[model samples]
Target: MSERVVRPVGRGFLFLDSHPAGCAAVVRRMAAEVEPRTPERRTALVVGSSSGYGLAATIAGLARYGVDGIGVSFEKAATARRTATAGWYRTAETAALATELGRSWTFVNADAYADTTKDDVLDLIAGKLGKIDHLIYSVAAPRRVDPRNGETYQSALKAIGAPHTTKSLAFDDGVPVLQEVGIDVATDDEIAQTVKVMGGEDWARWITALQDRDLLEPGFSTVALTYIGSELTGPLYRQGSIGAAKADLEQTALNLAKDGVTAMTSVNGAAVTQASSAIPGIGLYVSLLHKVTALQTPVEQSIALWDQLTGETPLDLDDEGRIRLDRWELTDDVQSAVRAQWESATQDNIAEVADAAWFLAEVRRLYGFDVPGVDYTAETEVDVEWPTTA
Candidate 1:
C-alpha cells in the first residue's frame, strides 16, 4: 500500500474557510495586476482545473477578476468505501464558495486529451460563458491517447544516456526508510513516446478547435506550466524526456502566437503535487531544494506569474518568448547551497540537511491534510454539491 495519504478526508468534515482564506491573500496581491474588468463580457477556460496551478488560476479568476469560467478536469468522485480524490473536494469547495460570493463557474469532468472533451468544453463556453478570454493548460498526465489515431503514448521520467543513482526515501512499515535508487536512461523510442504524450499537441488542438468555432475572444491569452530544475536533477527533469516535451511545447507556443493569441510556457519551481510525487528522485531533490531556497508554494507563485502575464507590462517574456518564474529557485546562491547539500546528502544525513518534516507536511497539505487552521476533527459533508451560478 502507498504510504502517502491519497485520501486524507474520510467521513469527517473538512474546514472550508481556510482554503479560500489562503487564496484570498494571494488574490489581494493579484488584484494589483488585474485591470478592472467589465463583467458579463469575460470568460476563462482552464484544462485540468481541479488542482495545482489550474485550481489556483480558477480561484484567482473568480476572486480577483470576477470572471466566469468553465473548468475541465478528470477526477473521480467519492464512494462508500473509497475516498474521493482531493481535486474533487477542492473543486466542489471552490465552486460552492465562489457561488456564495456571487461568482459563476462550471466544472466539466473529462479527459483533456480527448477531442470529445474539447468539443464539450467549447459548447459549455459558447452556451454558458460566451467566449473564452483566457485559457490555462495545466494537465499533467503520464499517458495520452492520440485523438487522431487512438494510439496511446506514455511518458517516461529518466535520464537520456545514463542511469542516475541517488539516495532516496520511501515509507517502509510506516517509517521513513532511506535507500539508494538508480533510475535508468531512456531509449530513443521511449523519449519520443514521452514527448508525444506530454508535449503541446493537445493544447494546440484545443486552441485551434476554439479558433475554428470563433470562440476565442480577441486579445485572448493562454499559458501552460512547465518546470526546469537545477543541474543536480537535470538528468531526471530538465534534460530528460519530459524536458523534450516542454521544448516542443515552447515551439508550439511560438506557432500559436502567429495565430494572434498570446501563448507561452511558464516555468515554475518544483513543488509537492500529486503529479510531481510520481517523478523518480524528486522527493529527495525537492526537500533539499526547499531547504536551500525556501521557495513559495505553487499558489503564491501562480499569483505572481499571473500578475506578470496580465499586468500593464504586456507579459514579460524571455528571448524564447517564455515566462521565467523559476528565477528564485535558480538563483546562484540557492543552487549553490542546494548543490552543497546534495553532495553531502546520505541516508543518515538527509534528515539534517533537508527539512524532512516540512516536506511531509507540505505533501499532506496537497491532499487537504495538515493545514494549520483546518479543523480535521469536525464532521464534513461528504456530498458537497458544486456551487451554482448566479
Candidate 2:
C-alpha cells in the first residue's frame, strides 16, 4: 500500500479524501435548527454547489429539510500527478452521505456561466427530481466569458472611489505575519468588467432559463450570496467594484421578484472561503473578527441563515429585501470592538490579538486537511470516480 503525502501548502492545500467526520460536523451542527421547521420535502438547484455555502446547504437540505438537490460546480478532476480540487472530493463524500441518509442528488462538474451547464442541471431536475422549490446561487469567479458573444470580462477587488490602505496577513513559511497592503481605485473599465463578471447578469440568466423550461415551481425562492462589511473594510468591499456588482445583483433581485419568483440576496458574514482568500485585506479582517465574534463555521453559518428564512422571522430583510445574516457581526458593540482592533492591528500585536491558528486550520479544513481524526498517513488513491446523474 502506498501512502499519500497530501498536506496543506502555504495558504491552501488539498487532502485526497473528504473527512467524513468533518462533513458530519456540518450536518450535525445544523440538524437541530431544522427538525421542527417548515418547508419540508423540497428540491433545490444550487449553482455553486460543490463547496462553501452551496455544499453546506445541499447536505443540510437533504439531511434536515428532506430536499433532494442537484449541485453544479466547476472543479478539476484528480490526476496521477496531483489531487483533484477539494470540491470534487466533497462531492464524492456528499454522495456517500446521501446514500446513507436515503437521499437523492446529482453533481455536475461544469462552468456555471455556461448555458449548457444550466441546461444539463435542469434536465437532471426535470427528469428525476421534478420542479425545484429553492435555488441557491453562490458562484464566485475572477473572470466570466459571455455565453452569447464569448467576450471575456474580468473582475477586480479594488476600492471604487479612492486608494485604500489596510493591514493584512501573509504566510511566511507557514507562519502568519502581518503586512501592509493597499487597494487602489479601480478604473472605469475595471468597475464595468467587475460588474459583468460578479454582478447579477449570470444569475438573472439562470432564473430566466429555469422559468422558460418551467423548472421552477410555484413559491420557488432564490438566494444569491453577497457580503457588506463594517466601516473598516467598506472601502475595499461595500464601496468597491464588487459592491457595484452586488448593487446590480440587488436590482436583479427586484426584477426577479416582479417575475413572480421570490428572489433576494443573502448577505453572509465574513468568513474565510476559497473566494475570500484572494481578496487583499480579508484574511486579516477574518482573523481579527474572531476576537469579537464566536466565528461560526461556514457550513453552520449557511444552515443558520437558511433556517432564518424558513423560521418564524419571515427572512427579515432590511428595506432592500436582502437577508442579513451578518446581524451578529454587525451589532453596534461588535462593530465598535472590531474597529478598535483594526486600528490597533500591528505586526507587533497580531499574534497576541488575533487567532491565527484557528484561521489557518479553517482554511486547511476546507480542503480536507487538518481535520480531527483523519488519518493522513493512510494509503489513498489519487483519483476517484465522480457521482453521475439518474
Candidate 3:
C-alpha cells in the first residue's frame, strides 16, 4: 500500500476526491453519539447506505437497535492514483464499528436500482439474516437505469409551472458569493424523468420482492426519506421536479398502506448533504436555517426517527400520514427569521446574516474534509479496505 497527503480536491460545489481517513473519522464520530438502547437482535436492509441520511440510518440501526443486516450502495473502489468515493470509506468504517459492537453486517457495492442487485440482497438476507424488520430507502441519485426497461432516467432540479428566480449562495474559489439564480421551468419529459429516477417505484419493488421471498418479519416496516421544504424554497423544491418526485413517493407510501405494508414517508429537515448541494437554492436556505435554528444532524434525525418507529408512545404523523421531522426547521420563528435574512443578505454581510462558513464547512465534511482532528497535511492512506461485502 501507499501513503500520501490527500487534500480536498474539486471546484465550487463539486468535489473530485474523498479522503478515506476523514470519512472513517466522521462515521466514528456519528457512531459515538448514538447510545445503544436495545440489545434486540433485529435485521434491517438499508439501501443507499453509504452517505448522508442513509449512512446515518445504518449507524443508528447498528448502534441503537443492535441490527445486523445488509447495506447497499454504489461506490467506486480506489485506484493506484485515485481515491475512492466517500461512501466507500464510510461503509467500510461502519462495518468496522459494527464489528466492534459484535454485530454482523454486509456491504453490497452495486446499483440499488437494479433487479439483479435486489435479488442478490434478498439471497444474502435469507442466508445471513433470515428476516428483515426494517427497510430504509434513502437513495438520492441524479440518474437511474430502469431495471425492467433498461432505459436511463435522469432527475432534474427545476421549477414546474413558471421560471423561478431566487437569491442563492455560490462559491467563488471557495469563498461564499451571494448571487441571483434563476431556474427555468422544466419540460414535461424532465418532470417525468425526475419522478422516474427519484420516485418510489424502486422502493415499492424492493418491498414487494422481500415479501414475495418471505423475508419480511411479522412487524416489518419501511421508511423512505423525503423532504418538503418550506414555502421559501417551494418554487424550486417543494413545487419543482424534485417535488413532483416526492409527491409520487408519498403516494407510494399510501399505496403500500393499502397493501398492508407499514411504510411511511419521512420528511427530513434541510441539512448540508451532497444531494442537497445540487439543488439550486438549497444552499442559501439551509445556511440561513442553520443560522436561525439549532438544526439536527442527519445522525440525530435518524436516531429520532428510529425512536419514533420503536418507541412506546404512538408514532406522530401529519395529516397525510407522513412523519414530520422538519417541524423544527419549518417553525414560524425560524422561517420568519430566514425570510428576513433572505431579503437583505449580501456578500458583505453573509457571515452575519447566514452561516455560509458553516455551510461550506459542512459540505466539505461530506467528502471527508474539514473534519476535526484529522491532519489533512499528513500522509494518509488513500486506499482503504471495505470491511465486509456480499
Top model by lDDT, which number?
3
Worst 10-residue lDDT window for candidate 1 reads 10-19
Runs in model 1 deviating more than 4 A are: 1-41, 173-176, 386-390
Candidate 1 on 89-151: residue-level lDDT in tens?
677666765676577788887899999988888888888878888888998888999988999
Give per-residue CA lDDT, model 2, range 1-390, as digits (tens). 223656554433224444333433433443444443344677888888777777767766766665678888888876665667777777777776677666778889999999888888788888988898889899898899999999999999999778998787776666778888889889999999999999999999999998999888878899998888877778888899989998999998998986668899988888877788777778788888897788765566676666764563467688888988788888898888887887887878887687777777777777666766667676565466687652
- Against the true structure, whose TM-score is highest? 3
Stronger candidate by lDDT (2 vs 3): 3
How do all the candidates rank in terms of TM-score, highest first?
A: 3, 2, 1
Deviation from native of the Cα of residue 377 in model 3, angstroms? 1.4
Candidate 2 regions exceeding 4 Å error are: 1-3, 10-39, 308-313
lDDT over C-alpha atoms for residue 352 of model 2: 69
Write down the lDDT that model 1 would get.
0.72
> Which residue pairs overlap in candidate 3's backbone?
none
Candidate lDDT scores, in order, read: 0.72, 0.77, 0.89
